[model samples]
Target: MSEIVYGNLLYPQDDTPDETVLGCIRGARDVGVTTFDTADIYGMFRSENLLGRALAGEPREELVLCTKVGMPTAGGPNGRGLSRKHILESVDGSLRRLRVDHIDVYTAHRYDPETPIEEVMWTFAELVRSGKVLYMGMSEWPVESITEASRLAQELHVPLVCHMPRYSMLWRVPESEVFKTCDDLGIGQITYFTLEQGVLTGKYLPGVDWPAGSRGTDLKGGRGPLMRHWLDADDALTRIQRLAPLAEDSGLSLAQLAVAWVLQHPSVAGAVIGASRPEQLHHNAEASGRPLEADLMSRIDQILGGDLIVHSA
Candidate 1:
């Protein structure tokens, strides 16, 4: 498995042509990236369609294709949840769109309070038994929910292999409980937001306006609102700037340093990275397998002090 998994969340933008998207996916594969992750809710199912078309003729065994379910895909009570019906229907849709016989890792995008843990686990087991999904994963779930599902997975003999979480130097909510719980459960993590939506790249200055096409200025897609926390925190932005010198000392760009920091964790199996341009994939892929010294890690923490960081629940 590749250390860096290419995420298709924001790829194939509104104006980007199908050919361009296909080239980007092939470019990522050529750079040694083997895992590709997308979701049914991403781009309202357009992402999966595009990804399916992009990877049509690739060697299926060499790639790890993952997609998610359990998000509101339609308007009605049965539209979205971990219910057996929804999961069953969603898997077929994903399979059709991805042009795959079976998914490498099928993840639950969010916990479904409306569905019982037993129902969720049994549904996943059915999928695994039928060869529709090889492994199960959960994203952004509470510790209690993950534990309950894990317990049920064990009872059902299902393979609950990964937990997808939003983990980064600036956002450390997983450190408080999720990390230890997943570690104890023997579940690897595939982390997203490792770059904190590009804030950790030191591109957005403390005082200057955001770059023209940056996510900080993308209001229509809801990315700007997600970035407001860091954008509004001048002290955090200033602290991020301080890390630039450290990144230079390590002979890496700020973005590379950010990606490397997340991959340093033992439980992290891979970090999901999104690339709009093909060159961006090559740049970010350099962070894989590069180890940072312990002293450098400590210095990074010192530079971005605890006050500006969220290190716990």
Candidate 2:
């Protein structure tokens, strides 16, 4: 299994030069990363465009390109949602921006409350049959929704290979019910935020002024507020500090330990980590193929506490 996946969520901004993003993408490829994940909403479409540019010369067959839809790409009420019209339109935009004839995995960014499940599934079924998408998936969907969608997918004879969710030592929402539902439905999990927006990197020390060049400092695009829960939770921060030695003893960095911990679950197929610089890929790739022993796993669970919030949202 591919343990770590490169995510375009935090790809270099639209105004920023493309050289950094291109270097990061190629760096991951050079390090043997076969799967790359992105979304239409990422960077408001800039991420896909940059990734398309970055992968221009790579062997198409050797790389697995995964992308998503169902988020607003433009203004107005028609901008987003999983309606057949929106999906049909969005897939083409994604394809053109990605410069790919067919996407290996095309996922629904989220369940659309406004659209019927049947409509969404049927659209995806059409995409698969038309050869534009190899498999279908969802992100951050509840178990009930997944079950309903899976039923429709089975009826339509389309393969729903996996679901993307935020899973890490910091968040275990999937373990509560999503994992079991997917397990029963034969769906895999491709988790994101394995490093908790770099919180698990041990760079954001408690009570320290938001460090220079950190996500917390860049409050633009509304990214900083998302880290408030971790930054404000004094207890979680203390526990994380204590965890540093344990990770060192295991010959793993805290980031690597957090990622490998997520992959320990049978339902998880991959963990997505966003890289802004090329060197970050090397640290993340090392997390793959590393085994964590039962005792260490138990110790980690105890440290995080049994009553950890299942979902961040």
- Lowest summed lDDT over 10 consecutive residues: which window, candidate 1? 10-19
Candidate 1: which stretches are off by over 4 Å? Answer: 11-16
lDDT of 1 by residue, 1-313 (tens): 7999998875223555667667778788989999999999887788889889989999999999999999888889888988999999999999999999999999999999988889989999999999999999999999999999999999999999999999998888898899899999999999998888888878999889989888787765636555898999888889899999999999999999999999999989999988767888889889999899999999998988889788765
**Cα-based TM-score, every candidate:** 0.96, 0.95
Candidate 2 lDDT by residue in tens digits, 238-312: 788878888999999998899888888889999988777889888878988888999999888788886654453
Clashing residue pairs, candidate 1? none
> How much does candidate 1 score in TM-score?
0.96
What's the C-alpha lDDT at position 304 in model 1? 86
